[model samples]
Target: MLEGHALGVHGEGVSIAPVDFSLARGGRLTLLGETGSGKSLIAQAIMGTLPSGLAASGELTIEGQAYAAAEGATRRALWGRRLALLPQEPWHALDPTMASGAQVAESHRYLRGLGRRRAREAARRDLVGLGLGLADAEGSLPGELSGGMAQRVAFAAASAGGAPLVIADEPTKGLDAPRRDAVVRLLAATPQRGGALLTITHDIEVARRLGGEVILLRRGRVVERGPAERLLSAPRSDYAKRLLEAEPSRWPAPPPPPATCGEPVVEARGLAKWRGGRALFRDLALSLRPGEIVGVVGPSGCGKSTLGDLLLGLTGTDAGEVKRAAGHRLAFQKLYQDPPAAFSPHWSLARLLDDLVRRHRLDRTAIAPLMTRLGLDRELLARRPGEISGGELQRFAILRVLLMEPRFLFADEPTSRLDPITQRDTLALLVELARERHCAVMLVSHDPALIERLCDRRLVLGQGEAVLAPESLDAQAV
Candidate 1:
């Protein structure tokens, strides 16, 4: 249903080497690579959405329609009908001004030519099928939904028309195990609809779940391709081998546990948060002790990120109190999930870091050593956040937070956007720094393996409260 022959992307002075591949109707293909390997570029090339000044070469055919020379409406029509993309960043993919339901209904209304009422009904059903309630899905705006909900809404938009070819770019980027499984099932079942599935991702588990074939890319070149199981198990190239080995599942055992947990550095008591008359969580209580790493896990929209915000005093609790031990306010820091949003678009990395250092009266000499330890180049400080890869930006984000020398840290899915290798490295660095400083760390993530490896205790949030689960007791906290 989709084919690319010697397809390449080039701009003013750079180019992505040409690559060749094809997917038959109902077939599945996964493009696997680390950050900066041109995975997204290849997807953009096929979708005919390459940025201005960057041109695509060779040929791209979808549903037997050649797009090399297609123009205007011809290309646009292919998007919602013959081809649809589930973008990497779900929040950005949506139209903030439009109601979520209306945006999703557009696929049915335009591509399938359904009546307004019918399209609305179909969209509601699609949303419900993806685990969202009819009321929440229909009434919420993009801004009103959680990251995971926005992702599901995007999926509904892409698949509503039953497009012949669906291209998903990291569809399960920020979801828990349950939601991830749901997405995997959704894509796996796409073939039964007489369509093809093409996904560009850095997740080995995602690729393995949507099994069929895998194409490995490295530095813009195709290094390997074969059946998913065979390719992953017996990769032919050295890069592919390293990629497989870098999976978090293969990481060595975590470092030895902290010798002794220190006094509570930050504490929350009887916390309650409500949004739009709905309770996110209530009467939540937790404490962060120095030298301890706490993991927060739950299904999406269960208040994990919100809890992080509350702990950091970034958001006010509707009821109850958050208490930081004396002199610990400035010693508290947070690592946001969306690094781009956390930064000002107008500020260069240098300016942002400098401002932080200046405001905190921190020594400038501490900057270079932290950057080196995080595997970040000192040169990156000169570029804006937009100019760097997500992994790099995440590293810098961590660096910026760490520079304050916080005694307690709140990290919300810090490695969600990163590839496995980068994820491992970033986690290792964060843990190391936290240990050296004897800082208390609260890590919010959906990856169970990560929680098990890094956390001394886990907090499971659901149904309006967080239940603390200590590793030693294997018992739930009241």
Candidate 2:
């Protein structure tokens, strides 16, 4: 259903090597690579949504319709009805002010030509099919949902128009193993219905599950492409081998139990929180000791993030008290799930860094070395938050927090957008620095393997029965 010859992305001083492929109906093609390696760029090129300053080159044929790949406009009208692009870290893709159901309904009403009543009903059914049938879910705004919840909502909205050919960019990010599998099933259904699918992902497991063609890329170049079964199981290229090795499941166990922890940096007792008329958590008790790495896990909207916010004092709790060790006011920091949300889109990263330094009286000398450690380019600092790739911006957010020498940090899916090798390396650097500075860390990730690999202990949330609730909270502190 989709065919491309020498498909590539081109821009000032950068370009993705030309690639050729044909995705027949009922076939799946996954683009796997490190962050900024141009996985998403290919999807964008096909969707005719390449960001400013970048252009697509080559020839593309979709559903027997041929067009110049560079003519982005030629495919514009097909965006919703024939082609759809599911964005990465989709919270930003959703409408913050609109109710979830309404957003989905909009696509059906306009793109699919459904009436208001029919569109609304269709949207409701879509949400329900995705397990978002809870009475309150359809009414909630993007801000009211968890990272995973927001991602599903975006998916519902994007696919509402019944687009046959789909481009999913990191569709399973910020979701637990079960949710990830569920989404993969959903993506698979498109091809089963005789539509073609092109997926962009960093997850080796996701590619294995998709079970079709796989293209491995690095630094805007294709290292290899072949059947998923062969490429992933017995990759020939060195980079491919390294990429597969970087999966959290293959990581070596962390060094013996975290160095004898120091005094508690923060403590929460009998903590409880309720959102949108549902109890998210109750009787949750945990403490963070200096230099201790704690991991958080659970299903989407299970209050993992709410718990972090409670500990960070970002929100008020109905029943709990949190005490923090006396230290610099800025010592407590959080690396947000949506890194772009944490920065000013209007200002350059350098300006934001400068502002933080001036506001906190932090030392500027540490910036260069920290940037190097985080694998960031000095030139990137001149771009605004909206200008860089999601993974790049996420790393920059980490750099900002590290500059303050935080005593306690809540990293909320900080590496969700990053590729395997980068994810492993970034986490390693974060662990090393946190240990050296004796900073407490509360890390949250959907991958159980990743948690088990780096955390001193794990806290699982959402194994309760209260209607999208955590009242009967199952607190397993492993």
Model 2 has how many clashing residue pairs? 0
Per-residue accuracy of model 1 over 17-114 as CA lDDT, tens digit each: 88888899779999998776778878887877765556778887777777672232357767777788888776557888899999989889988999
Model 2 scores worst on lDDT over the 10 consecutive residues at: 464-473
Each model's Cα RMSD: 3.0, 3.2
Q: What is the Cα-based lDDT of residue 378 in candidate 2? A: 93
* Model 2, C-alpha of 451: deviation from truth (Å): 1.1
Q: 17 in model 2: Cα distance from truth in Å?
A: 1.1
Give the per-residue lDDT of model 2 (tens digit) for 78-131. 998999998986666888889988999999999999999999999999888777
The CA lDDT of each predicted structure is 0.81, 0.86
**Which candidate's TM-score is highest?**
2
